[model samples]
Target chain A: MTGGYGLLVADLIGVAVFAASGASAGVAKRFDLFGVAFVGFAAALGGGIARDLVIGAVPPLAFADWRYAVTAVLASVAVFWLHPKLHRVRRTVLVLDAAGLGLFTATGTLKALDAGVPPVGACLLGMLTAIGGGLTRDLLTGEIPIVLQRDIYAVVALGGAILVTIGHRLGLTGLGPLVTAAVLMTGLRLLALYRRWSAPVAVP
Target chain B: MTGGYGLLVADLIGVAVFAASGASAGVAKRFDLFGVAFVGFAAALGGGIARDLVIGAVPPLAFADWRYAVTAVLASVAVFWLHPKLHRVRRTVLVLDAAGLGLFTATGTLKALDAGVPPVGACLLGMLTAIGGGLTRDLLTGEIPIVLQRDIYAVVALGGAILVTIGHRLGLTGLGPLVTAAVLMTGLRLLALYRRWSAPVAVP
Candidate 1:
């Protein structure tokens, strides 16, 4: 029960943080309230939706569970009101974004395992779940995807996903494994952020 | 057998045309060959993939059906070799794009119906199948979606989807109704293109 509760809390926090990032992007683009909400929802839920669809889990849990949608909306509203202040704390946002990334990667891998996806596929789905929402958000705002451009973002997510998927395949499906993966993922992301590590851009 | 062959032909043509447009976008952006291929595949098959996932069709047909993947790659290669000349025939590309829109919308709606989706959901799926690829393509290329910016693009697809969905709901699933819907959709898209119709943008 505690494990399930912890997972739920982590998932909700991830959703809220991702939604805020998306809403910030919408606000930066001067989108209207509806537009902000749309961006936020896409960012919070798009990755999971994509992962679920690939695994044939219909009506994606995001749609089946109203709390996810509500969380995204509330986050968007909060950002809409506090965007200027939020912008000033960009470092904090980045930290939270990394935390969300770790949470999502772990959760996504777990869901894919539950759906009986192969380890490799589950790992990919986990990474997708971590990066997909941000991709959607940036794309909608006419910006290059951050995952494609900077930091150890997707790479870290991919590592976490792979770790979790392997753990699951090895019959290590519990809070301990999940927490370890999430912590490792979050730590790597933050370290990369502070250390200014980036994926190499292809020379044109 | 004949009906199945014809549907296959139509689907391939749509994929090729959409792939061409995506490859053209990649070429315009001076992307690498891999990037061009990526954009082409996304543009050609992303929509159907999205639609299939929403309806619980796991492991999307594009992944399961090698032919679809092959067609997209061939189209991408063709574009890479012929983009300069192809770019000169902008008008022809527009016409082909409209045709693709109509074909995908019809086929997508039919697939949704076959999957037992309700009429309304089927119609939405059809429209999504038509627009989703182009949306992904444009967004990835850092442009506002053409469907949202100019022409009666998505609107026409939605109209065609509604017509086909309604026809199916009313037991009018014959080729005659489907063909008529496709023709009307293609025609409306062309008309909108030539007439410079635009979706209303909200004033900031």
Candidate 2:
């Protein structure tokens, strides 16, 4: 498509996955429906909204369109209804979350670069966007954020963002480069999960 | 002085009060020294930092000005050294917190307007700046944010922000109006606390 629709599809899918993860996490933490909805909204749009606000995009995503709200609501409902039955599918959920993280990381890098942020800053925004939701969710539940201590979580996103930044500067083929970055992030994340890899828990 | 420097000095005093509240809250919550410092930092700068990032101001206060970091650290250290001795001063601490809340509420309102935000949004942002840190602190510690489930938390800041907005619009002179707004908020909050007022708990 010669339009923004293609990217919008990816963004929506990413939103759904992020919301689902948040809702499921909320359920596990024994939060009420409102709390679940808050987590879902934070997970899905927190990063994008933060990025947009930073770039001075007025009336951010929370107010921009109804779709974002709809996605969060739907995700919350889905988790509220299905989480009990899906408890065994933690692996599947993790895979879906990894895909969403990859998608959001790409979106962050692209949006920041589009707004004229420098390469390093763009990458930083990308990683922040990918991890911000999870961080908020964890913090709200009185747990250490996974990003601050996890299996190649932020590092994978940072690596992908760096590649996206470099690719944009080098005038690389868009789809080819995007796929490379996304696959790298997703693959690394999944492998880390499967291998039970984790960062050292030393206090710095 | 026509220059805002005079206003800035008053605001710094409020910031110091805010730092003390943050440090004490951390101590009351059983946080270690590092946690106390983090809480103090969050309490002192969380609001302004959020405002700056949302407005796309680069390198937030914690990084740009050494004073913010110094203020948080000093407050944390002071609390660490004095908490045991100051145990009898719980009432005084609450009074100081009220005072800090007033100062922060006023400064938050001014800062949001100075950034050229619309009246309603600016007012909301101002309130957020005043109470955002405490909210984050409570949530991170697995308690309901005082703002969400307490009497007159958001409402006070809202009033302060609106008063300041209207005062500026009417070309009101001096710090009188801002002070009035803060006093209103702080007084109301203290009343709420003294009366043991609370929001009804949500039934799951």
- Best model per DockQ: 1
Off by over 4 Å in 1: A1-3, A32-34, A56-58, B1-41, B62-135, B144-204
Question: What is candidate 2's CA lDDT for residue B201?
Answer: 30
Residue A96 displacement (Å), model 2:
7.4
Question: Chain A only: TM-score of every candidate?
Answer: 0.95, 0.90
Over the stretch B1-204, how does candidate 2's per-residue lDDT look in tens digits?
212676666656566666767777788888898888888778777877876665545686667878667877787788878878777887877777776677777776676566666666566567767777786667545575545433656666767787888987888646777777778878887997888765433233
- The 10-residue segment with the lowest total lDDT in model 1 chain B: B29-38
Tens digits of per-residue lDDT for model 1 on A45-128?
Answer: 999998878877778888988999999999999999988787588887788888899988998888877876666667767888
lDDT string for model 1 (B1-204, tens) is: 114777788888889999988877876776655557657878998999899887877767675566777799789878877776765888888888888899889889988998989888999999999999989888878877877776678889988998888888789876677778888999999998778888887889
Best by lDDT: 1
Deviation of model 1 at B103, angstroms: 12
* Model 2 spans with C-alpha error above 4 angstroms: A1-99, A112-125, A147-204, B1-10, B25-42, B56-82, B85-87, B117-124, B135-177, B195-203
Docking class of 2: incorrect
